[model samples]
Target: MNPASHGLKITEQDGVSRIDFVERNILDEANIQQIGESIGAVVDASPRPRLLICFENVEHLSSAALGALITVNTKVKARDGQLRLSNIRPQILEVFRITRLDRLFVIHGTAEEAMDTFG
Candidate 1:
């Protein structure tokens, strides 16, 4: 699928799907919903999905965006899939830490590092 049409850039390699956000700020409710759906579709397409979401472009995100991510995580787990988050900026990482979501997710400093863990 062309995830870029829905504000995401996607690439797949070695049975893993990597998603990068096209937007710098993921604060809009509508956009967040679309993102959730886009990622959800990717998850659904795989029997045992391996997804890496790179936050290289994102500078800010709302609480609703966090909720959407949590939802995506839940869906991944339900399918016995793996989800990794990478390239998160310090400020955004701080927010994840404050929310204790840092523990809920497996985060990495770079997409390459995250991809290495997919094995």
Candidate 2:
């Protein structure tokens, strides 16, 4: 399913739903909401989803974006699904660390690494 309108590029392989952000900065609240909704749909579509969100193109993200990610993570967990975040830039990783989200998420250095973790 193509969700380009939501500024995301999605692909699936080996039962893993991988999402990549099209925008470099995800600071807008409206865009963040759309991203959350789009990803939520992906999570709901599968009984046990394996989602990987890659931040390779994203350089900056607002707190609202983090909230949206949190919401998506909650939905995935509620459905007994797995969510992994990869390719996060150093600056954003610092933010995740500062907010203690690093502990909440199963993050990896690369999408390949994250993909390998999916059971």
For each candidate in turn, the TM-score is 0.95, 0.96
Once fitted onto the true fold, the runs of candidate 2 whose alpha carbons sit more than 4 angstroms away are 1-5
* Candidate 1 minimal-lDDT segment of 10 residues: 1-10
What does candidate 1's lDDT look like per residue over 44-118, in tens digits?
A: 999999999999999999999999999999999999999999999999999999999999999999998998998
Q: Could you list the CA RMSD of all candidates, in the order they appear?
A: 1.5, 1.4
lDDT of 2 by residue, 37-102 (tens): 998888988999899999999999999999999999999899899999999989999999999999
Alpha-carbon RMSD, candidate 2: 1.4
* lDDT of the candidates, in the order given: 0.93, 0.93
lDDT of 1: 0.93
